[model samples]
Target: MKFKKRLWKKVSSIVLVAILAISVTGCGKSVSTSADASNVTVVKVGTGNGMPPFCSLDANGKAVGYDVDVLKEIDNRLADYQFDIQSLDFTTLLVSLDSGALDVVSHQLVKSDVRKTKYLFPDQYYCLSPLSLAVKTDSGIKTLADLKGKSINESPSSYEYSLLTSYNQKTLGNTLKINAVSDLSTADNFKQVANGQVDAALTYQSTYKSVQADLKIDNIKLTDTVLVEDTYIMLAKGQEKLTAAINQALKDMLSDGTLATIAKKNLSEDVFANYTSLIQTTN
Candidate 1:
C-alpha cells in the first residue's frame, strides 16, 4: 500500500506539470493572435454616387472608378490598411467628415479657402477637367462675348456657378441671366439649354463630354481662359497620422506612374500627365 500511494503522488505531479505547460503555450498563442489582429487598420472613406469618373457604384453594387482605384492603390501600398466606402451626396461630404462620421472624403472635392479652414486636404491626387461653356451645335455662340446677356443654368452653390459668376463679372463685365438648379440628376438645367429654354450651360468639361454626343453640342468653347481646376481628397482637421500616410502613399504612387496608368484607364486620357504641370504651377 505504501508503494501504491507513492506512485499515485508521482502521477499527479506529472499531470499537473503537463497541464501548466499547455496553459502557457495556449496563452502565448492567444497573445500573438491578438497582436496580429491589432495590426489591421480600418479607414472610413466618403464618396458621392452622383459623381462619375471620380466615384460611383457599378451594376454589381460595388464602388468602382478612378477614385476607387486611387484609394485601392493607397491601401495596397499600406498593406495592412482597409477601406470602407460610405456613399453620400456631393454637398454632404464635408459636413459628414466634420461630424466624425467619416475619416476621409475620397470624392472629387476641390480645395478652397473656406474648406481649408475646416478640413485638412492632402496633396491633390487628381486634378479634374476644367469647366467650360457648352452650347448646342446649332447655336451661333462661339466665344465669351457671344454669351453676354444670355441665360445660363448651373447647379447652385457649385464651383460651376462660382466660376460662371466670376467670368460674368470679370470677363463679361456684366452678370448674365442665371438659373440655379439643385442637383445634376434632373439635368433640367441641361435640358433647358438643349430645348432653347436657356441660351447656354455652365458645367464641367467631363459633363459636357459625356452628353456632347447625345446633345449634339458642337460649339462648346472655353471662354476667358479661366480654368477651374479641382483637386480631390479631404481629411478631418487634426487627422495628422492619416493625412501623412495618405500623402506619402500618393507621392509614391505618383512617382511610380501608378496614378497615370489608372487615370488613363478610367478617364481615357493621361490625366496625371496633363494636370501635373497645372498642379505644380498652382503650388
Candidate 2:
C-alpha cells in the first residue's frame, strides 16, 4: 500500500507538469497570432487638391501627380505594405500628420529647421521652382533693397514668409509690411500687387512663369536668394521605419532615373539634377 501511494504521487506530479507546459505553449501561440494580425497595417498618405504637378484629383476622383507617382513607387518597393490616399488642404495636411490622421504627407513640403523638430523629413524627391518676388511691370521696384518700406504679399506660414521675415529681422532692422494671404488660388494677392494694394508679392518660379506672359510685369526676376530649393516627403514623428523605407525607395528611384524622367515630363527641364546637387551640398 505504501509503494502504491508513492507511485500515485509521482504520477500526479508528472501530470501537473505536463498540463502547465501545454498552457504556456498555448499562451505563446495566442500571443504570436495576435502580433501577426496587428502587423497588417495600412499607411494613409495625405495629399492636397488642385496642387498641380505635386497632387491633384482626376475626374474619376483619383489622387494623381508627381507625388502620387512617388508614393506608388514606395508601395511597389514595399510590397508587404498597403496604403490609402486622403486629400485635404496644404495647411490641413500638417495638422492631420501631427494628429495621426495621416501616416505621411506628400505635398512637397519644404524642409525647415523648425519643422524638423516636429516631423521626420525623408530624402528630398523634388526641387520646387525657386521663390521669386513678383511685382507689376509698371512698378519700378527693381531690387530687393528697393522694397524696403513697401508691403509684400505672401502665403501665411509659408517658407517665403519665413525667409523674408528672417531677412528683415537680420538685415533690414525693421519688419517690412507683410500681408499674410492664405490662398493662392484666386490670385487675390497678386491682384493686390497689380492694383497697387500691395507693393509686391512673393511667389514660386513656376507660378510666375505661368502668369508672366499675361501679366503686365515689366520684369519678374528670380532673386539670387534661393529660399528652400528642395521639397521633401515628410513622415510624422516616431516613424523611423517608414522614414527609412521612403528614403531607400527614393534613392532607388534616383538610381534608376525614374525621378529625372518624371521631372522632365512635368517641368520640361532636368529638375532632378539640381535637386541631387542641393541634397549633396546640404548633407
Candidate 3:
C-alpha cells in the first residue's frame, strides 16, 4: 500500500507540472518579448499608424517603418530595456506621451522651444525630415514668398505647423492662411489641395511619393523649396537614465553606419548625407 501510494503521488506531481506548463503557454497576455524579465525595463513607445515611410502598422498590428526600425535597433543595443511599440494616431501619440502612458515618442518627432519645455530631447538626433510645400502642379507657387496671404492646410500638432509658425513670427504674423485640421490622411490632405480646398500642404518628398502611390496625384507636385528639420526621440522630462541610454545607442548607430543603412532602405536615400548642408541652405 505504501509503494502504491508513492507511485500515485509522483504521477500526480508530474501531471500538475504539465498542467502549469500548458497554462503558461496558452495564456497570451502575460507573455513578454524578453525571455527573462527580472532585470529588464519595458519601455512603451508610441508612434503613428499609416504614416508610411515614417511609421505604419503591419498586418499583425505591429509598428513597422523607418522610425520603428530605428527604435528596434536602439532596443537591441540596450539590453536593459525592451521597447514595446504601440500604434496610435498622430494626436493620440503626443497626448499619451504627455500623460505618461508612453515612455517615448518616435514618429519623426522634432524639437522646438515650446516642446522643449514639455519634453526631454536627447542630444543625438536620429533622422532628418525634409519638409516642403505640396501644391497643385499649376498653382504658380514658386517660393515661400508665394505662400504669403495664400492658404495652406496642416495639422496644428504637426512639426510643419510649428516650423511655419516660426516663419510667421520671423516674417509676418499669420502670413500663410493656416487651416487647422486635427485628423486627415496624407492622401486626403493632397486631395484637399488637388480639389482646391486648400492652397498647399507642408510635407516631405518621400511622404508625397508614399501618398502618390496610394492614389492618383497627377495634379499635385512638391515644391523645389525645402526646409530640413532634425527629428529627435522625445521622452518625458525626468527620465535621465533612459535619455542617456538612448543617446548612447544613437551615438553607436551613427558611428557604425547603421543609421544611414536603415535610412536608405526605408527612405529611398541616405538622408543623413549632406543633411546639414540642406539645413544650412534652407535656413
Candidate 4:
C-alpha cells in the first residue's frame, strides 16, 4: 500500500508539471500572435485638393502626383506599413496633422521656424523648386525689387508675401503696395499678371508650369528664379522613430536615384538637381 501511495504521488507531480508546461506554451503562442498582428502599421496621410503635380484627384478619384508616388514608393519599401491618403483643405491639412488625425503631409511643404517648433521635419529634402515672378511677357520685371511701389498678387499667408513684406520693411520702407486678391488660385493670379491686372504674380516654377500646361499662359513669362524653396515631408510632433525611419528611406531613395526618377516622371525635371544647385549657390 505504501509503495502504491508513493507511486501515485509521483504520477500526480508529473501530471501537474505537464499541465503547467502546456499552459505556458499556449500563452507564449498567444503573445506571439498578438505581436505579429500589432506589427502592421497603417499611416494616415493628409493632402490638399486641386494642388497639381504634387497631389490631385483624377476623374477616377485616384490620388496622382509626385508626392503621392513618393509615398507609394515608401510604402512599398516598408512592407509593414500601409499609407492611406485623405484630401482636405490646405488649412485643414495643417490642423489635422497637428491634431494627430494625419500622420504625414507633403503638399509642397517648406520648412519654417514656426513649423519646426511644432512638427518633426525629416533631415532629407525630397524636392526643390524656384519661386519666380509670373509677369506679362512684355512687363520686363526680372526681380522682386521691381515690385516696389507696384501692385502684385499677394497672399497674407505665403512665403513670397512674407519675403516681400520683409523687403518692404527693410529697404523699401513699405513703398511696395500689395494687391491682396480674394482668389488665391495660381491660374487666376497668373491671369491677373498676364492681363495687366497685377504687376506680377509670385509663383513657384512648378506651379507656373502646371498652370501653363493646363491653360495657355502664353502672355506670362516667369522671371529669374528668386527663391529656391526646399520641400519636405512633415510629420506631426512626437514621431521621432517614424521620422528617423522615413529619413532613412529618403536617403536610400536618393542614393538609388529613385527620387530623381520619380521627379522626372511627374514634374519632368530633376528636383534634386535644382536643390543641389541651391546648395552650391549658397555655398
Highest lDDT against the true fold, candidate: 3
Clashes of each: 0, 2, 0, 0
Writing each residue's lDDT as its tens digit, candidate 4 over 74-113 gives 8667655668878776767878887789999878777766
Clashing pairs in 3: none
Please write out the lDDT profile of model 1 over residues 1-283, one tens digit for every residue: 9999999999999999999999997776231222364786788888876556667677786777788888877766664557787777778876788789888997666665666777887774554555556666667776656777888777766655665676677874556877886765524556666678888766655655555545554444334323546576788887888788888888888778888898778777776666544442222
Task: Write the residue-wise lDDT of candidate 2 on 37-142 in tens digits.
Answer: 3564588888887666567677798877677877776776764456787878888988898899998988767777788888887774545455556776766766
Q: Quote each prediction's TM-score.
A: 0.75, 0.73, 0.83, 0.80
Candidate 3, residues 1-283, lDDT tens digits: the string is 9999999999999999999999998775432354555778889998889898889877798777899899889988887788998888888887898788999998877777678888887888898778778899999986777888888887887767776777788886438878888778888889999999999888887888887887877888889746787789999878889999999999899889999999999888888895756762211
The residue-level lDDT of candidate 3 at 179 comes to: 84
Give the Cα lDDT of each candidate: 0.69, 0.70, 0.83, 0.77
Candidate 1 residue runs with Cα over 4 Å from true position: 1-35, 143-145, 211-228, 277-283
True-vs-predicted CA distance for residue 194, candidate 3, Å? 0.6
Which candidate would rank higher by TM-score, 2 or 3?
3
Segments in model 4 whose C-alpha atoms lie over 4 Å from true places: 1-37, 173-175, 180-183, 279-283
- TM-score-wise, the better of 1 and 3 is 3
RMSD in angstroms between candidate 3 and the native structure over all alpha carbons: 5.4
Q: Using TM-score as the measure, name the better of candidate 2 and candidate 4.
A: 4
